[model samples]
Target: MHSSTDTGPDDAVGVGAAVMLVEDDRRVRTAVAAFLRAKGFRVAEYDDGETARRAVLDAMPDVLVLDRMLPGLSGDDLLRDIRTRSDVPVIMLTALGASGHRIDGLELGADDYLAKPFALRELQLRIAKLLRHRASRQSPLAPFTVGRFRIDPSLRRITCDGADVVLSGREYELLLFLLKNPDRVVSRDEMLREVWGWNSGDASTVTVHVRRLREKIEPNPREPEYLRTEWGAGYRFTPSGRSS
Candidate 1:
């Protein structure tokens, strides 16, 4: 049976946003997709990692539900592949229950990983929290002046030291979030739920987006003048104007 709550849409959210569901389990896939559709989400179902990967390449979805194991490609492999190109949030669904494997998956770059035999309510809660977090980051409520970067949320534009720096929708959101928080360590979970939405629970989404953000706003994506990694903790943005 389908299970989800808060599927309702208001003036702020798109009622017809498309969600791509990739679960190899036929029964689960059918149930999840139907439930999501009932909640006003447009869903496309895929049964394999490879197919899901291809579909995402063709068109990015508003959300994703990816199974951890697939015949052609391992769920982890597909997760790695997605991170290489986009910061789309991912939540991994797996049958494995080992903490070690879960840790490995997070280290490999998943934003959030959920083992199989899960509850639909838990999944729904996670998805809702993640989407809301992401929307807030992307919204960019006001202009943020950070070091050499000045961001105008209304225009969805950014400039560095007076030079215009173009940003993709994802990049702008990631940068604005980091700048807004400034110097505080923003965890992977925070980035995933707030910046990318919990499409898939792979933390690598945060890394990729941060890397891309650095490339655009930082003086050097390598050294990262503005954005800095806090090792296992997460990341922080120290505006160039801020004194050490």
Candidate 2:
């Protein structure tokens, strides 16, 4: 039941952003929390999944740093719960460095993943990137429609055929990026750079999110009409909902 808040310096880069960090290891949590605080983020630290789950809604964090393993309710279970309730950005931390493990985390709705033994600076950068994305979504852009989907940027809401389509924060960003570039092939690397703010990363991350988006928007994900694979290339989004 360990929890505490560190209000970082007033002028730090991360100032005004709230970050919820759930990690069981005291040593790691303390170190990470301290570093984030120094960078000017309001960090709420938790030592286990169950406690973090209880505090999540109340905290309403800008970004969540969640460990893959935890006592009581596993991180995966907690993530599932979070997804059901909120689209708060999540960055999963795990000891597993395998690509499969990363894909699993991303598939489970994590906005980002960081393998253990990573540099503190890298983690901070990831958090900052997520914060930047969140901030960008708040921009007041005129609502637009492409085919059956209507996107209201001011509300960060999307509806398909007048029915609300719930999407994770990352999912919305990915879909919006594809919609903005309709009828054009967008490489995975380009998606990563433009959507995920990553210069280089596993293409599987983009693949997993694309699959998720298809399941939500396409009547039949097996034969996706909105998002189509380009095999040797990347992906093409068709606003007309027809394979071209």
Q: Which candidate's lDDT is highest?
A: 2
Candidate 1 on 1-244: residue-level lDDT in tens? 3354443343234347666778888999888777666656788999988888899899987666678788788788887787666656566788887876776665445556678788775665656654665566554457778777788877777887888876555666777777778778888998866666654565655766677666766655787757788898988778773434
Candidate 1 vs. true structure, TM-score: 0.62
lDDT of 2 by residue, 1-244 (tens): 2223443332345576888999999988998998888777889999988899899867679889999999999999999999988889899999998999999999999989988888777787788777776776677899999887888998878888899988987898998898889989999999999988889888999999999999999999999888999999999999779865
Cα lDDT, model 2, residue 216: 94
Q: How many residue pairs clash in each candidate?
A: 15, 0
Listed per candidate, the RMSD to the true structure in angstroms reads: 5.8, 4.2
lDDT (C-alpha) at residue 138 in model 1: 57
What TM-score should be assigned to candidate 2? 0.92
Error of 1 at 223 (Å): 11
